[model samples]
Target: MKIILSPAKKMITDTDSITPDGLPEFIDKTTEIQKWLKSKSKEELKTIWKCNDKIAEQNFNRLENMDLYHLLTPAVLSYEGIAFQYMAPSVFEDSQFEYVQNHLRILSAFYGVLKPRDGVTPYRLEMQVKVGIGETKNLYEYWGDLFIAENSIENPEDIKGFKRLGYAFRPDLSSEIEYIFERKIETMTR
Candidate 1:
């Protein structure tokens, strides 16, 4: 079981078909991420899912607004060997490029790996983050074709193609904003 992230996004226009998990495993299912998740009670699932959404939404807002706070953090994959790529729900609904940008940034920065697609991004941005996974980097292929894969995988070796996993802005940097204005004022007065 391993986690995978790629940079090739396709339109999953099927709303009705989406599973209760909100994500159909059209991407990585390195290890039975769903099954493991399902082991939890419905309440626990809801709690974890919503909490992730809330924090992601909040941080995404700040990152998008503050052009200066350019950073990325290792998304701390909840369970290893269970890789996936995702777009913030807000961006996925509408074809907002910001979502694309942030999605790629988040993925690439954390995984330090991505599959390159020519038309997905312009030359400049693409060139900036094309660093492949480190030689030591380990990932299991979870099927390359996003549109294929009948919602999940039973075989581990079938994953071959790639998906869109973007590079994060700067992971180590903090998203928290500090009020240095007061400190500056005090220093000047002193």
Candidate 2:
């Protein structure tokens, strides 16, 4: 059973809380992407990032001094978005942490799929970002079905987790390859 999640735009350095289990699965691929990003000029990056001067400059500096291997934080604690804040991984017990490590995966444009405790550095890249990498026109084409296969569910028991999150299994919307979990608006508001 695996619960796939999107990486957050806002991230922070948190090496003090929990140590990372290991580096991402596709570190070499990440290095390749990093090199490609480094080749672009700041103005070019600003255009690619689609941001104003200040944010572009900050990420440009991050690209300049980015070290993929050092001063890493666990992927779960690196993000500062609403979803991550709600997750509240900082207060999780050992059993909860273990469950997350085994069943949760975070999808990243920069690092591919990340386990909960995977070592990660702060970077600004989204799955929808259009950048030429190798022969691919955009990240969607570059990633293809890799993430889908990585997060594919083989066990029927996996469906139980979604129920706990207020998501009901939608058999009408689901097929052999896709499992849809829909939460009602009323349930979400609560």
lDDT string for model 1 (22-88, tens) is: 2212223312333333344544543543446554444334323322111211122121222223433
lDDT of 2 by residue, 6-103 (tens): 78888899999989998998899899899999999998888888889998988999889999999999999998877789999999899999999999
Q: What stretches of model 2 exceed 4 Å from their correct place? A: 151-190
Query: TM-score for every candidate vs. truth?
Result: 0.20, 0.78
* Best model number under TM-score: 2
Residue 15 lDDT in candidate 2: 94
lDDT score, residue 90, model 1?
A: 24
Candidate 1's TM-score? 0.20
Clashing pairs in 2: none
